[model samples]
Target: MTNSAKPRARAADKRRRLATEAARVLHEQGVERTTLADIARAADVPVGNVYYYFKTKDELVLAALSEHSAHLDELTGRLDQLPDPHDRLKALIEAWISQRETAARYGCPTGTLAVELDKRADGILDTEAGTAIRRLLQWAEEQFRALGLPDPDDLALTLVSGYQGMSLLTNALRDPDIMTRQGAHLLRWLDSLKDTDPAA
Candidate 1:
């Protein structure tokens, strides 16, 4: 409501929009093929304005990485709301199922981006580049721990790996239904773990 606060809010909104668009573009085009102009066009901001917010392509990409991390956090935070850890874990697989089409088209947003960054010699890969999936894995680990599973760490690895692996296969085969089937399979596995006691 205040005059100064209004401008600050507007600036923050503008930057968030820019970063989100950049992330979408990078997801569609991969990191090396995408340009600031491509991102600016997607965001409906001028290329010159992009330079005003980010001095280099790498800076913009890092902003996109932040955008992805924020998205991952929001997703896991929602999973945290479920009353049952088994439900929460199953919901994680559901989230991936919901985006199966997009994965079939562009791959898993977090996984593909992390893979691209890892393969790149560009320094953006060094700076919080793969944290989105890493953070997701950590979140899953927490959920497994909450479930009192004997092998929380190993279970978390299975969950995250299944997601990434299915994402890759779905994308490679252009078969969105692969994720649907994978979700069903993971749900059954989670059910089998519901009664496990970590201390036993």
Candidate 2:
């Protein structure tokens, strides 16, 4: 029993390591450029081992995309700390921009992969990524509604679009200034809303 369990444990560990390395490679080089061999080298595993866990590159890419959802959870936790709903929105926006500043080369993996999958009409990963994004937007909308904001659903969707658009621009421009300016602008816009609303 102990010997049998050892192999299973090792296989689980190998899968975990491969998944982590795949995510890092996908984030750095994207799904198109990152190859299975590249992932194997980064993962410090044999190429055959990578294949043992994933039959094709698509599988690895999808797994990495799923792992990336954890990033959204982290953002949600950070946004939840703010007491005011307006501040929560601002904090969420600013924190995301700040994160993009650090993760510039990788861009937003969720958005990037979703866009790529859409072009190919790869329905499975595309649907998974879209679901994660929609969940985030829904959460933001609920926060806005809690603050009694008008058209919270529309505003939340708009904000999500703006955030992704800025991330793409920041990557193309390679300028932190754009992120800084855009983040401040978002905060200012929220401030204006707060000024008008008594509940805020």
Candidate closest to the true structure, highest lDDT: 1
What lDDT score is found at residue 96 in candidate 2?
74
Q: What's the residue-level lDDT of 169 in candidate 1?
A: 96
Error of 1 at 152 (Å): 0.8
User: What is candidate 1's lDDT per residue for 113-144, written digit by digit as tens?
Assistant: 88888876755664476677778778888888
Which parts of model 1 have CA positions greater than 4 angstroms off?
A: 2-6, 122-127, 195-200
lDDT of each: 0.85, 0.79
Model 2: per-residue lDDT, tens digit, 138-160? Answer: 98898878878789898788788
Q: Residue 126 in candidate 2 has what lDDT?
A: 78
Cand. 2 TM to true fold: 0.88
How much is 74 displaced in model 2, in angstroms? 2.7
On the 0 to 100 scale, the lDDT of residue 90 in model 2 is: 82
Can you list the residue pairs that collide in candidate 1?
none
Please give the RMSD to the true structure for each candidate, in Å. Answer: 2.0, 2.2
The worst-scoring run of ten residues by lDDT in candidate 1 lies at 191-200
